[model samples]
Target: MKNKGVVFTTQAAMIAAIYVVLTVVFAPFSFGSVQVRIAEALTILPAFTPAAIPGLFVGCLIGNILGGAMLPDIIFGTLATLIGAVFTYILRNQNKFLAPLPPIVANTVIIPYVLRFAYGEAIPIPLLMLSIGIGEVISCGVLGMILYFTLNKYKHRLFAL
Candidate 1:
């Protein structure tokens, strides 16, 4: 039992660290209204492990702060990731292909507002939505799906906790 908890904590911490690295390393494409945060691909991990819920949230929070996001972006953007991770965990039993949908939708719906109101972007809200949505689709849908498929093949070995 103690080992299980340790494994879960370790997994979550590792995931969070990986997310921060990906976000910081890809800073150019990880921020701004027209951005594709490659770290979002990790959002799909919730479908395999519940620890990812908080992992992604904390990761996004730190990533946002380190990325020089405004206050609202840090708050709301982290919430968006948390919500998506929870939903993904809830839907874990469904089709593997659906694992990325929650993050895609959550970020698509929440980030544009963060951009317009938080960052005071001059771009119209609808256009921001379009751009953010496109970025989410690429990060969560395309890249996440690729990750999902690859990890699915080694779930037992990689996520055995």
Candidate 2:
């Protein structure tokens, strides 16, 4: 039991660190209106292990702080990620194929408001939605699917029992 707990803790921390690092590395595309937010793809891991929820939320908080957005970015930005992660965690068990889409959808649905307000783009709502949603589809939907397959293949070895 001790070993299992240690493994879980280590795994969660590693995931959070990876998420923060990825967001930092992709800081340019990750912030402001036209965000790709590739790190969000990792949210699907929560389906396999619940640790991913906090792991991702904490990761986003760290990313927001370091990425250098002022108040709104730290507050609403992290809030958006937190909400998206929660939505994903809730629907994680419904279907393996469908699990990744929730976070993508959640972020897509929520991020446009942030973009419109934070960046003040003259872009229309549909355009903003399309841009953010498409980005998420590529990042969370497409990349997340790939991660799902990779992790699923290694579930026995990498994940907790």
The numbered model that scores best in TM-score is 1
User: How many clashing residue pairs appear in each of the predictions shown?
Assistant: 0, 0
**Residue-level lDDT tens digits of model 1 in 1-161:** 44988888988999999999999999999999889999999999999898888889889999999999999999999999999999999999998888888988899889989888887899988888889989999999999999999998999988887
Candidate 1 off by > 4 Å: none
Q: Candidate 2 at residue 34, lDDT?
A: 78
lDDT top scorer = 1
Residue pairs with colliding backbones in model 2 are none
Query: Per-residue CA lDDT of candidate 2, range 13-105, in tens?
Result: 877899899999998888766778889888888877766777887888898889887666677767777777777778876877777777776
lDDT of each: 0.92, 0.79
Worst ten-residue run, lDDT, model 2? 69-78
